[model samples]
Each structure stands twice: as structure tokens, then as C-alpha cells.
Target: MTDDLDTPVLDNHLHLDPRHGRGVDAVKDFVRLGGTHLLVVNKPSWHLGVEPDEPTDFRPVFEETLDAVAAANEVLPGRAWPVLGVHPGLISRLVDDRGFSPEDARDLMQGGIEVASEFVADGDALALKSGRPHYDVSDAVWAASNAVTRRAFELGAALDCAVQLHTEASEDLTDLAAAAEEVGLDPTRVVKHYAEGRLAGLTPSVMSEKDRLERAAESGEPFLMETDYVDDPEKPGMVLGPKTVPRRVRWLLEAGYDDAVRRAHVETPRAVYEIDTESTLNRDT
Candidate 1:
């Protein structure tokens, strides 16, 4: 694929896990395939099926992820950028031996407005997890996770980074007030990465595309549409694949929600939560 291909929408939720053996070459190939900016999001600790849930064979994927970004920068010059944060499902890793840090625990109790506002108020995007919308406890967690969620948010926001989440059916977030309250992260502080995408082995029903938009507007958060791909087709959507980006972009356009699609995966996200763009900028931790 070359840049001469379709008009590339901003690549919002492209996830590259070192565990998957993706290289900087793939990143350049994406840009060469017509992408303007490629936002490399956080992935599960390792490869699916072959790797354990958390990485036991290697160090945290974050470090390798940063290395890949460095390679991407070298390969594409100003294209590959980094987006850092913990996934809701992976929040377990962020917790100490006890659990989520006390601050995060408290934030989870309150609505996260004040707690999250304090952390990354200086950063880019406030990344948080809304779990699955259909789940009962997720609503409670959404109202709570905000405490420390924004610390990372501000860090990214200060750099104009976008918050991209890996959501599941049990992680439905169509209700703005309900979702924001449930996860405890400030909806206004970040853009959700995959509020409308389909999850594996789950029903296709969503919080109605129209209602999803209204929720985004009400929460003051930009919505993101992404292809959380897995390279092994045996895994399908587990990792962000090379073929999925444009295909999903076309899906959004055909739905006549191109503008919403663009903001979630492109414009707003790039302009806000991704300071890791361009290899030369190098902000990987």
C-alpha cells in the first residue's frame, strides 16, 4: 500500500504489540499506504493464545512498544507517534500488590471530575476505561476510575494526545452521563477509542449510532472508531492489522458519519492526545 492510495484518515487506534512481532517497516507501510499520522495505541500485554495474558516471556509491552515507535520514527520520519496508557481490562497491572493505587481507588468512588482533573491537567488526553457498557459493574467503575485516569490524560493532553480505549460488549459506553460516572474518568478530558466497534463473540447491537453521537456530545468527548487488529487472522481483531484501517474508514464514510469517524480516528485525536507522533519527537517512557 502507498500514500498514493485512498485519502488516509488519521490512524487513531492502531495498536502494535511487540509480542506480535510487528516492525517499524509495517508502520512506514501504513503511512506509505496513505496515512497522515499513525497513532500507536496500547495493546494487551502480549500476543493472543501463544502468549500468556500478562507477559511472562518478556518485560512489559510498553517498553518494546516504545522501541517499535523509535523504529517507526526512523522508518517514516514524522509519521509514527506514541499513545501511552493502561487499558481498562489491563488496569489490573497498574494496581499495586494491593489493588489500584489509593488515589485511583478514591477516584473510582467519586465522579472523577476533580481527581482526574488534577493529574494530567497539564497533559494531552485523559485515557480511561468504560469497561463494557452492558455490564452492571462497569457503570460503577466508570464513575470511579477517573481519580488517576487524568494523570495520564493531562500528560497526553499537554501534548495533544487522544485517549483510545479497547472496549468490549460488556464495556458498552453509549450513555454519556452513565458511562462517565461509571468509569470515574472525565469524559471531557479525552476521546474514547472504540465506543462503537464490534467485539468478538458479542452481539452486534450498539448504543444506537445516533445515541452514541449524542452521548459523545453530551460528555464533551470525541468518539473514536478503530480496528483493534491482531495480525494472526486466526485471532482476527485482536491486534491492529494492516488491512483494517482503511476498511473501517470506508465503513464509517458509507454510514454518512464521516465527520464523527474522522474526529475519533483522526483530526481531534492527532491535534490533541498524540504527542508521540514523529520519531524525532520521541516522548516514549
Candidate 2:
């Protein structure tokens, strides 16, 4: 077990699929490691399937993921939140493998955005996740995917929820704030998930690596940390483990960077997700 810290850490992004056989045990382990909060994301390819015969419907997957979050809260109430949306890669998968026409693929994405909005409006989710940029796709598919992402931003703006982006690591987001402004969404509410370097005016939920986390800390930028933990048995802790953020917090504390630790694990999450761990924990108690 990792040594506990005085302050609690939040893993802002993680995949807690039961298929991996890491259900309540995973949540219990995380709490033991001093992880106080988690943002569980739904990836259709992970839960459902990529093939046509498999259930292509997204609603069930979304609901099931939400249920997973609620179940985690039952085990550790107010400690887990949900993020629901259609992955940007799913758009290309439908067009290329499933033989969905570009128009149909876009329409499906639009439908996903609508469902995501409904989930947020109903308080089932903390944010809307979309806008993964695929650089290798044909220009037509690329444009269509981006249009779907833009629509997600528009819906998030209308409903007052944040939109998390899953884009290429090298992609520049200098225009993200301006684009969001044009669509009536606050720039700060647009999160760049699995991010690396700092964007000019965007919030990044950065991957937990020593070098990356150190740089982000030294830069004194406002950011959140995530392991992007896939929780696949085959690839156990693919990106990083569930305990990553808390371990990083221990490192920060040892290095005497208390303020940075608090900002990354506490302040930024509260500001972005509008969640207060202390208050939630108090209520739970």
C-alpha cells in the first residue's frame, strides 16, 4: 500500500469497466491508496463492441457506466463521477469498418451529443466528453468528426456542462478558447484529456508521468492529473494505474510542493468539475 497523504487526490479520468473483473475491489484499493475521487468515463468500444452484430446502441452502455459510477458511490459514496459521450474514433470506425456513410456517421454522432446533453441536464454526468481529432482520416471524415465535436461544445454551452476532449497529443489548441467563445462555452470549461504540454488558454487533464507531471508542476499551470487507466485484464494498468495520481501527490509532498499538489488534486478539479471532495466526504460521513 502506498503511504497516505494529508490531502486527498482525485483521478480525473479512469475506465472502471466490470468486464476486467476489477469492480468494487478496484474502488476499495483506490480509496486505500488515498484516492478520494474519480471520474469514470464510458468508451463504447471497451464496453460494447466495434462489430456490427454486437450491440451498436450507445444508450445502454452510457446507462451501465453511470450505474457503475453509482455503485462505486455506494461502496464509497460521492467518490466517483461519470463522463458520457461517443468517442471521436468511433466515428471513423463506423465509416470505415461498419460501412456507415459519412452523413450517417455524423448523424449518429449528433444523436450521441444529444444524449450526452440529456445526461448532464439530468445530473447523471459531470461533463460531456467528445472532440477527439483524428489526423489520419480522409478530409471528409475529418471534417465530419470535427463538426460533431463542435456540436458537442454547443450543447455543453447550452446546458452549462464542461466538454472533455480526447485529441492527438501533438494537436495545437491555441484556437480552442476562441472557438469555444464563439460557440458560447467558457474556454475554461473545455478540458483537453490525456494532454501533454500546456495549451495557451485551455485546461489539461494530464497523464501521470514523472517528467510530464514535473514539467506541468514547474510551469505552475492549472491542470489535473489522470492515469487514463483502462483497467483491462490483458493490459492491466495500460496507461497508468488507479493509484498513480495519489502516488504523484506523495511525491509532490515529499518534494515540499504542497501548493502545487493542492492545486492539481483539489482546486483544479473543484473548479472544473464543480465538486468539493471535503464537503462531499463530510456529507457522506
Candidate 3:
């Protein structure tokens, strides 16, 4: 299984949140998981106005970083790909980028993000001391969200590009279709991101995945695959912990699921992110 990991992989949900502090080397860490490609969620750029007043720098929104990430991936053969798109949800200036380390991150945002583990290393000790992240969202935020949505589609169309967007964004597929239609594109040309898993109270993600496939069949529109890299206790978020990406990938194989989906998530996403224009199969079919 470890041997298979080096064979190449795909990762769907890559947040190069300015808050996340990513750099060129993120390619190596991703490659460890066979991450040859990534769907860089610039979804956070939708925030309109209500930004934090604290002079603290907000990491460049995901939209602004996609070009760099894509270039970074291209530097490494079969190593990097970036799915450029804006994130959903209003971006609040006060929002904490990292799950628990916002304060430590405040000072670091202007520079860049370190490793995911570096901030969470203290685990329980830090968890015990952690505080909540807050923000001020005014009418400007709602306004920004609306504005960014239009702006992103306009920009993507002009660039002749597609972008990564949350599955929830599908609620407005009509609006998306309008944009594509306005630009003389088949609605299928738009790429929706992170369509998976059934979260309680959230609509079934499976339906969206199936919808994506059906749409592709009809439109020949190329859609990318992605994962949020959820920290599942059902599948615990295992850190390097004496294991390498290949080793952990092997463990995931043992945990059990569809082999095709697993391989696509790890291998195919990497390829797509790195801009390899291969056909995406309907493994579920």
C-alpha cells in the first residue's frame, strides 16, 4: 500500500487560506499523500466589507493565492495542481484561520503559515487553554458575499477558467448557470467542489456527487475531485507519528471503503491539481 502512495494521488480540499500560511514547500507534504493536485479553495474571498479593524493582516484570500499554488505545483513534475475558486460563507475579519491557534496566528499571518501540526502539537495542553474565535460581521459582509460571488464568476469566465466552490454553493446553481450562459458556456463548465459525506442536518452530499457525474456525462464538463481531509475519529486524524504519507495511506486502505474513491481522493486529485488534463472516470458507476 505504501508503495502505491508514491504512484500519485489527488486531494480535493486544499485551503491555502492566508490564515493557513502555506508556501511552495507545501507541495512536498502534499506529495507525501500522493497529492499530485489540489482544489485550492479561495472561497474566503467573498467577504465584502466588515473586516477586522485590528491592523492584523488577513491572509491573502484563496482566490489571490491559486496562481502561485498552481505555479508551485508545476515546478514539481506530477507533483502539484491547484483548483482555483472562492470559498463560501462570509469572511469575517475576526475569524480565526487555524482551529485553535488564532492568537499565535495573529502575529504570523503577515508572514506565512507553518505546518498544521506545529500549531496543534501541544494538543490537550493547548486545547485546554484555547479560547473562542470571534468576528464582527456588518451589512458590509452580506454585501461583500453577494459581490464576490458575481466578481468571481466574471473573473473566471474572462480568464476562461473554472473555480472550486463548496457543494452547498449548488443551492444557487441556477445563478451559476446564468453566469455561464451569459458567458456562452454550458452550465457544466462550472466546477463545484467538495461533494461528499452526509453531515447531520446538512443535505446529503452523495446526491451532489451523483449530480456532478450526471452533469459531466451530459456536458462533457471536466470536474475535479476533493476532500476536506476531515479529522475523522472513525478514521482518526493520524499525524506523521513515526509514519510517512505512504504508511498512513496504507492504514487508510485497511480502514476500508471504495478503492476507486480512495485512490481518486489521494491520487487523482494530486494529478488534477498539478494540471494534468486526464479524463476523470465515474468510478461510482
Candidate 4:
């Protein structure tokens, strides 16, 4: 795939586990296939072999994620930035395996996001990742997870950065949008990661797929595209391939989606993450 596109091709949600996956090579695959920017989100604590008993325990998790981002940037400078925080699924582990109460688990997760906010505050990262568990769970656990998500929104507001949410597959974010508003964050700044496009009241970082892209493009509502590439060797190309975003961009362009492509890749990201992705890619090129 040629990298001759005029606008930047950005993958909004990606993970690079150097220990157990293609890691930087996966990122290289994206860059080689015309991807110009990546928001490298942190994998779960357990994925990196960390069992957090306290908030500071997440330090290693964030550090290693940042290391992976650094490694990616070393090879492809100005291409990757981090979105660090505890994965919401870890709450199940904390309450089930680690023997913590639901409330404690929720607080721990919030604390983890708070720790992550320090990196954003220091300007080491661009966004924060947090959300409730996508799978089924008890009511108490669900409540706790929602609380953690709200804490993430509050932190995002304080840092004046975006929050990338990994939640259930639902288009209605009415409640979450209200929570963000309640916390003094602009609801538009909250991105629903792994989103199905045309979300009710927030930015949808829709997964890169033909039909989904078509619908999102036709809707005329601003949205971003992502591969959500997990980069796991065992489950290689789990969610989507690393090159999916750039490849889809090409497909959309061929289908005469120039305005949609520009809106998704450049306008939405600049408005949400406050990054000049197109200009940044232009300068780097």
C-alpha cells in the first residue's frame, strides 16, 4: 500500500504488548500500509504481568506502555502517543481472583486512572482510557465500574484531555454523557472506543470496517476510525489488522468519500484530542 494519501490516517485505539505480541512490528505494519498516527492504549495490568495491590502498582503498567510507545516512535517518529489507564475488565479479576470488595476494586481502578492522569498532566500522553466492563456482571460490580468510569471523566476534565471509553456495545451514551457533563467535562470530549458509529451523544471512534465506514460516512456526523489492533501473537489481528485504518481510508477515497475521510481522520481528532494530525504528518513527511 502506498503512503501517498494527503490526509493523515490515524488508528484511534491500539495496543502493543512487546512481551507477548508483534509489538513494534505491528506498528511498523501500520506505518508501512499508510497509517500516519496511532493512539497506543495500554493493555490490561495482567497482560503485562502486573497484579496491582495498590494504585502505584499501575506504575509499571503505564511505564511499559509508554516504553512501547517510545519504541514505536523511535522507529516511526511523531507517529504514536499513549492513552494510559487500567482496563475496566481488571475489576472482575480484582473482585474475583484478588479478593477485593467491589467498592475497593472500583476505587483501585479510579486510583489507577488518577495515576495515569499524572502522565497526561506532564504531557507524556494525549488521552486517558477507562470504561465499565463490556461483558455481563453483577449489579454491584456494574455500579462500581460505572463509578470508575465517572472518575475517569472527572480526571479527563481536570487534565483537559480526552477520555477513550471501552464499554458495552451500545449507541445510547445518554447517561454517560450526562455524567461527563456533571463532572464539568464537555461530553464531546469523551470518545467511545470500540464504538459502533452514530453514537447517540458522544464521539464515536468506530472500528474500521467497510459497511460501518459507509454508514458513518453517510451520516455526516464526525467520527474517528480505529483497528483496535491488540497485537497479540496468539490472537494475531484479533479485532482488526494494524493496516485496517489506512486501507479503509484508501477504500473510502476510491469510493469518493473525500469529505468523510477528512472529517474522520483530521477534523474529529483535532477537535477531540486537540492534535493537528494532518499538519503533523505533513511536517514529518
TM-score of each model, in listed order? 0.53, 0.92, 0.45, 0.96
How many collisions per candidate? 49, 0, 27, 0
lDDT (tens digit, per residue) of candidate 4 on 29-106: 887777778899999889888899889999989988889998887655337899998899999999998889999999
Tell me how far the alpha carbon of residue 42 in candidate 4 is from the true structure, in angstroms, after superposition: 0.3
Question: Model 1 off-target regions past 4 Å?
Answer: 1-8, 46-60, 91-162, 166-189, 197-223, 231-240, 248-266, 274-285
RMSD of each: 8.8, 2.5, 12.8, 1.4
Given candidate 3, what's the lDDT at residue 106?
35
Question: What is the C-alpha lDDT profile of model 3 across 203-267, one tens digit per residue?
Answer: 11122233343332233223334444322233323221111333333444454423534434433
Which scores higher on TM-score, 1 or 3? 1
Report the lDDT tens digits of candidate 2 across residue range 248-272.
Answer: 8888788777887888877887887
Model 2 segments more than 4 A misplaced: 1-3, 50-56, 282-285
Best by lDDT: 4
Instruction: Judge candidate 3 at residue 259 and give its lDDT.
Output: 53
Please provide, for model 1 over 188-244, each residue's C-alpha lDDT reduced to its tens digit, 9 standing for 90 to 100: 434445444332221111222344444443443444444544444346444445545
- lDDT of all the models against the reference? 0.43, 0.77, 0.35, 0.89
Ranking, lDDT, top scorer first = 4, 2, 1, 3
Which lDDT value does model 4 have at 228? 85
